[model samples]
Target: MTGIATSCATSPTQPSGVAIEAEKIRQELAALTALYEERNNQFFSHLHPLLEGSAFFKESVQHDFETFSEIKMNIKITRLEIRKEDVWTSVYWEGTWKVISDASPLLQSGQALFIFSAESPPRLMETRGESPFGVFQKAGTPAADVPISTRE
Candidate 1:
């Protein structure tokens, strides 16, 4: 079975495809978080090349940057898991976030769902549960989680 052996040898030895995808998404998230936390928009260009916009591009990416600047909130990804389907990959992610100027001394948790291409950069296709205030707000209702971060 030389042919079989050759094919096996040529194949990748990664543990799980989902894990790999999760890691890539993690990196991207980390970079974005750092930018917001640091409030440094000068480096925005670094993310421009990697941006893979889908139908929710404006609401998810563009508005996100704007919101980040408005509220000065920071994100820390706590967990991320990915599942692969026939034609798409779904990701569940949780993060600890807080406003830079808030009185809260500790971070709070928030989560979001994303569907991507399952390839490099993931090419974000869809997103759900993206709170503009970053999981922290006066009211704890899903609908009340407005897409605006209030500094006061």
Candidate 2:
């Protein structure tokens, strides 16, 4: 009975490989998000390459963003979900985003793109369409839906 209770109370641990990979993905997600907090053009400049090679980055068309030049743009990811078409093709994501720029805070959202294709590599992905979360339009899309104040 005690053994059963312990097993039920605590979820079985995942294999070491899965644990490690999951952690790696978490770290990657964190790093991608951190790019937004970077000042001036640092964020866009540094994160561009990472955003270019993913199918999900449908919006990160090469010529779209020369720079992620913003005065004070910050976004916090609120949700993330993943789906895959096959072992080689999978989708990585985020659900919510919040922005704190200059001197105010606003709730916004965004999605990212990635490709695990070793030869092609993965990108941070980009976004499109109007957003309700805030002023972050991934890499290629417009920020019109997002307030300009937040864009800066």
The most accurate candidate by lDDT is 1
Tens digits of lDDT, candidate 2, 48-97: 34344333332432222223332232333333333342012123333322
lDDT of 1 at 115: 39
Q: Following a full C-alpha superposition, what root-mean-square deviation does model 2 have from the true structure?
A: 9.3
Alpha-carbon RMSD, each predicted model: 8.5, 9.3
What is the Cα-based TM-score of model 1? 0.41
- List where candidate 2 sits over 4 angstroms from the true fold: 1-15, 39-104, 110-152
Worst 10-residue lDDT window for candidate 2 reads: 85-94
Candidate 1 local distance difference test against the native: 0.42
Could you say which candidate leads in TM-score? 1
Per-model TM values vs. the true structure? 0.41, 0.36
